[model samples]
Target: MTDQPTTESKGQDGPAVVADGLTKVYDGFVAVDHLDLTIERGEVFGIVGPNGAGKTTTILMLLGLTEPTDGSARVLGMDPARDSLRIKSRVGYLPDEVGFYDDLSARANLRYAAELNRVPKAEIDSRMDQLLESVGLSGTADKRVSEFSRGMRQRLGVAEALIKNPEVLILDEPTVNIDPEGVRELLDLVQRLRSESGITVVLASHLLHQVEQVCDRLGIFVSGRMAAVGTVAELAAGIEKGHTFEVEVAARAIDAVTLMELVPGVRSATLDGERIVVTADRDVRPEIVELLADNGLGLLGLSTSTVDLDSIYHTYFTGAVNHDNVNA
Candidate 1:
C-alpha cells in the first residue's frame, strides 16, 4: 500500500466525496441543479431516483467524465476536473453496463484488470484468489466469461473495481435488469466490502429496495435535483409531517379511529374495517394501546410504516417531468 491508493494508505479523516452547488446544464435544460452533497469516509451512500433523474449526470461530474455546467465537485479531497487522473487511481468505478471479453476466462480477465491497475506482481495472484472467493466466483474462476450468468458478470465487475484496491468505489445502476436473487447477492457483497475493508462507496441506482437493502445513507434525486438525503427513517420523518402506523383490534373499533385523531401526537386516523391507520408526528402507539385497554378492547397487532421511497419520489415529481429535455 506504499505510495499506492489502497484503502490502507488513504488516511480516512474527512469526507470522501463532496459537491457544493454542483450544477450541470444541457443546452437550455438543467440536468443537475445546484446539488450539494457530502459522503463520509467508510460509508455506503446510495443515490436513487427514476431514470433520467440526473443521477448519471451527477456521477459523470464526480468522475470528471463530463464537465459540470456550474459549480464544482471533489473526490478524495481533490478537484475532479483538475485531479481526475490521480482521483481515478484511488476511486474504482462500475458503470451500469459492465463489459468483459467473452473469449476470456474469468480468471484471465481479472488478471488483465490487476495488471492494468498496476497491482504488485507478487500480490496479484493472492488478491485475485481472495476476490474470487469473496465474490462467490472461485468455482467458476477458470470458466470463460461467455459461460457466466448476468449475476456472475456483475460480480466480476466488482472484482475488477477492487483490483486496484481503491479507497473509494462508485457504482451506477448496478442492479438493473438482474433477477431478484442476483440483486440480493450483489447488494450483500457491497455490505461485506464496507465491513471488511472500510472502503467509502458511492452507489447510484434507481432501485429503491436494492439501495435500502445495503446503503448506510441515501440521497433521493428528482428531476435534476435532490429532494431529500438521509437515512430512510430520517428522510421519511422530513418528507411528510410525520410517520404512520397500522393497528388492528380484535373488535371492530370504527369509533376508535375518530378517538385516535384526538391523541396528543396523532394527526389523523381512519378505519379500514377492523384495521386502524393512524398518521402522527411521532409514535402514539402507547397512548392508543392505553385507550384500547381502558375501553376493554383487545389489541390484535400493530405495525409502523414510513413514507416509502416511491412515495417520496412522487412528492417531488407529482406530474410528468420531461427530463429528456436535457441531453446531458
Candidate 2:
C-alpha cells in the first residue's frame, strides 16, 4: 500500500468534530478513556470496534445525551455539553435500533420527525417527499412502517434523520440486522449524501466490511481506547507485518526456493502446486515478473494481498500490537 499522510498531520481550519481526551466512567468502570479524535468536514469517518468497546458511549457523549466523566468534545464548533440543543439542530443521528410509530406510514413518520425538529409546517410536505425519494422509500411512503422489512425500515430511518437537512449525520450501526442488498443500498445512500450534499458523516459499527466500504478514514477502538486511526492503506503500512503475493507460473523451470533467493525484498517463498506464495516487505509483483522472465518461466497469474482490517483489529484487541506504541 502506498503511504499517505495520517489524519493527525493534515492541516485544516477546524474539524467538523473534535474530542479532546474524551473520557467517560461509570460505577468504577471506564467506558471511554482519553480518546482524542478529529473528523474533518464533508468526510465519512468510521468508528469501528466490537460490542462494549464504548462506541455507543462515545456517540452519546458527542450528542450530549450523556456527560463525560472528564475531558471535552465539540460538534460543529459548539460544545455538546453547553450547546446540545443548538448542535442537534445541525446534526442528525440514527441509533442502532431505529424506532417509529409502527402504525404510521413511512411518510407520516418523516412528517412527525419534521414536526419534532420544528421544520416550518409550510415546507414539511416538500421536505418529506424529497427525503423519502432520496432514500428509495417513495413507493412505500404510504405503507405502514410495521409492514416494512428491517432493511426498509433502516432506509426510512435515514430519511427521517435527513428531514431537517442537517450538516452532519451520525449513524450507529446503520446496517445492523439488515439484509445484504439492504446494506448495499444504505451504504450507497451514505456515499451519495457526502458526494451530493457534502454532509459530514460519522458511522459507528462493529462490522469491518461495511465500515471499510463507506469510510474515508477509520478509528479503531479496543477496550475503550483508540488503537489506531488511518485509511486502510495507511493502517496496513504502519504494521510491522509484511505483505503477501501469490503468483501462478505456467512453466515448471523456476523453483520457488531459487526465486526467493534472487528477489531483493522477498522474505519467504513456497510452492503449492502451480502457485507460489511470496511474503515481501512491499509490493514485489514487478520483481517477480522480471525474475520469472529472466528464468524463461511464463507467469499465468499474479495477485497481491495486504494486511486487512480484520487482522489489524485482532492484533490490537488481542495485545499482539502493543497499545502504548500505537500512534492513534
Candidate 3:
C-alpha cells in the first residue's frame, strides 16, 4: 500500500538481463504484458508460475526465440531479437522438451551442435568431453540418444546445450522429466557452471523449493503478468502488517485476559485451543514473553511463520492457476 522504492541489491557485474514494457500477444490473447525485470549478472534467476502464466513467453523473448509485441529486451547488452546469432553464441538454452535423432549417438549429436556453432575442430573433442562429464554422460557418449532412458536423454540435452560454454543459460524445467537423483545432479551442475564460469542462469519452473534453493532472485507470473519479483526475503517483506501482536491464552489461565489488557499495544486478546497463533505488524515476541512471565502463565509454545511465495501467487491469480504448492 505504501509507495516505497525497492532497496534490493545487485552486485557489481550489472544486470545480465533487462526488460522494459515487454509484451507478447497471440492474436487477441496476451501471453505477456508490460513486464519489467532486471536480472543481475552471475546470479541464478528463476521464473515461476502456473501452466499458462507467460513464464515461457518471457524466456523466449529473452532468448530471441520469439519477438515481443511491444517494448524491448536486452540480454548481456545485446538486443536478443535483433542480435539473436550474437546472443546465441554466448547463451546456452535447454527447451522444456529436447528432441534428438534416434539413430545418432550422443557424441554425434553434440558434435553436430558444436559444428553448427562453429566451434573449432581441434576444440570440439575437448569441449564435448568436458560437457558430457559435467552432465554425467561421459560413459554414454557413444550410446544412441533414442536408446537412452528418459533420465539419460535429459542429461544429453543438458550437455548439448552447453557445447559452446555459453555465458548465460536458459533452462525450461531442466529437472522436470528426471527423477529426484537426476534433479540433484542437474541443479548441482548449474551451480557449478555459475560459480566456475561466472555464467548467469535463467530458470523457469513450477517448483518453488527448487527456486528458493538455487535462485538469488525470482519473479512470479500470474495471468500473463508479473505479480511479484524480488529475492525470497524481499517478497516476504512486501506483505502488510495488520497489528503488532495477537496472543490467545490457555483457557485454564483465567487472568490471561486481564493481564494482556494492561499491556501498551495489546489491542485485542482471545482464547484459542491448546495453542495460540498471532498476527503481528512488528515482531513482539520479546514483549509478549516478558508479560507472560510476570503474569505467572505457563506459555506452552510459540512459533513464527511468514506468508510464502505460494500465498503470494494465489493472491494475484486467485483460483486461475492449478499447480501443486511447494513448501516455503
How many pairs of residues collide in each model? 0, 0, 1
Q: CA lDDT, every prediction?
A: 0.83, 0.84, 0.75
Residues 137-194 of candidate 3: C-alpha lDDT, one tens digit per residue: 8898898888898778877887887787676788887777678887887788878777
Candidate 3 C-alpha error for residue 130, in Å: 1.1
List the candidates' TM-scores in order. Answer: 0.76, 0.78, 0.76
Q: For this target, which candidate reaches the highest TM-score against the unseen true structure?
A: 2
In lDDT terms, which candidate is top? 2
lDDT-based ranking, best first? Answer: 2, 1, 3
On residues 1-328, what C-alpha lDDT tens digit does candidate 1 reach at each position?
Answer: 2133445556756799999999999988898999989999888999988888899999889989899899999898899899987888888888888889889999999999899888899999999998899899999999999999988899999999888888899998889878889898999889888877778888998877778878888887887887777787766556555567999887767867767887898877888777888878777889988988888888889998656767555654553323322212
Candidate 1 vs candidate 2: the lDDT winner is 2
RMSD of 3: 8.6
**Candidate 3: where are CA atoms >4 Å away?**
1-14, 240-304, 307-328
